[model samples]
Target: MRQKLILERTNEIRCELNKVWDITKQYWYPLFECTREDLISFDSNYIMKSKK
Candidate 1:
């Protein structure tokens, strides 16, 4: 019974992680097309703006 409960909890955690991964992929997939320089510029701009 203890092992069964542990397996059930592990599956629950896996499902939650899959959901997060799906959402993350949606936002990040587009950035895959960005050039390295574009990403660097974006990172620098974000840092500059956040310093305010």
Candidate 2:
């Protein structure tokens, strides 16, 4: 029963990850193309700030 519960949670996480991946692909591709460098810079800055 515990194993089954774990499997169900894993599946749910996988589904959510796929949804997020799809949305990121759909929306970010254009922004990525337009400001590839700026996006990279912003992401790096955001990650650094978040770590603090």
| Cα RMSD for predicted model 1 | 9.0
lDDT: which candidate is best? Answer: 2
Across residues 1-52, which tens digit of lDDT does each residue of candidate 1 receive?
3544588898898779656544344344345443223324246677899999
Off by over 4 Å in 2: 1-5, 23-52
| All candidates: TM-score | 0.34, 0.34
Indicate the residue-level lDDT of 30 in model 2: 40
lDDT of 1: 0.56
In model 2, the clashing pairs are none
Q: What stretches of model 1 exceed 4 Å from their correct place? A: 1-5, 23-52
CA lDDT, every prediction? 0.56, 0.57
Considering summed lDDT, which 10 consecutive residues are worst modelled in model 1?
Answer: 33-42
